[model samples]
Target: MKKLITALSVFAFLGFAGAAHAAEASGRIAMADPGTSTLTLEDGTTFEVVEGVPLDGLAPGTEVTVSYEEQDGKNVATSIAPAQ
Candidate 1:
């Protein structure tokens, strides 16, 4: 019983560690380039939209929240949504 509890605790800790590496930003779109599949925030932070993460219908001046992860020294957006 104790061993099982310890294993579960370790798995939970690992999950949290993965989540810690992710980040979120909410702001208006400063620029969006469909040709490049990239976008920039109003604050000048740039993000590369990951494969399967939809950016359709979004345009400059649209407010959105992006969930991203840092990879290759760049922010890669995992998901994006209109800001509520």
Candidate 2:
């Protein structure tokens, strides 16, 4: 019963952890440094580009929407697309 309770606790924690990062942002790119895989938005938000998200189209003044999560106290983008 103790093992079962521990397993349930872990699962519950995982479920709620995902909800904490369910957020998105839309703004123009203020700075994009491919060397560091980092971007700064016009609103003064800084984010690190996650693997598999293309950066070729990102440039200063480009409008974009970003799906991101706060991991290790840093904003890491999961997806990026042109703002419609």
Candidate 3:
């Protein structure tokens, strides 16, 4: 029973740690470099987009909401969409 409790505690902590790495931001794009799969916001936050994430119609001055996770000290975008 003690081992089971310890395992559950570890799993819970791991889940929260993973959740903390995910985040969202909304801002106007300062630049969109499809060649590099990178997007920079006017506020200077940069995100590296993962493959299969569309960058269509994204350009300077376009407002967007980005969902990303911090991976290897870089913001890796999981999704990108126009701001409502």
Candidate 4:
């Protein structure tokens, strides 16, 4: 039963971990550097768009909402899109 308990604990931890990263709209992007795919938020925050992100129509000076996270103590943009 020890192994079962450990497996249950691991599964529960993983489930809660995903719930912790619940997509949230932190703020809006005000400036974008499509060359490097870096974005500047309205709150004066800058983000490094991860490689392979599809930023087709996203351009500089476009207002957008971002779902981000703090991973390894650094800002990580999970997803971003135009603000409603």
lDDT of each: 0.89, 0.88, 0.92, 0.70
The ten-residue window of minimal lDDT in model 2 covers 15-24
Clashing pairs in 1: none
TM-score of each: 0.72, 0.76, 0.79, 0.56
User: Which residue pairs in candidate 4 collide?
Assistant: none
Q: Which candidate wins on lDDT?
A: 3
lDDT of each residue in 1-84, candidate 4, tens digit only: 999999999999999788536345545556667687777777888776777666667766676777777666656676787778
lDDT of 3 by residue, 1-84 (tens): 999999999999998787746799999999988889999999999999999998777989999999999887889999998899
**76: Cα error in model 3, Å:** 0.6
lDDT, candidate 1, at 68: 89
Off by over 4 Å in 4: 1-23, 26-28
Query: With candidate 1 superimposed using the best TM-score fit, by how many Å does residue 61's alpha carbon deviate from the native?
Result: 0.9
The residue-by-residue lDDT of candidate 1 on 1-84, one tens digit each, is 999999999999999778638899999998877778898999999999977876678888999999989886889998889999
lDDT of 2: 0.88
- Best TM-score among the predictions, by candidate number: 3
Clashes of each: 0, 0, 0, 0
Off by over 4 Å in 1: 1-20
Candidate 3 global TM-score: 0.79
Look at candidate 2 and give me any clashing residue pairs: none
TM-score of 1: 0.72
Question: lDDT (0-100) at residue 2 of candidate 3?
Answer: 100
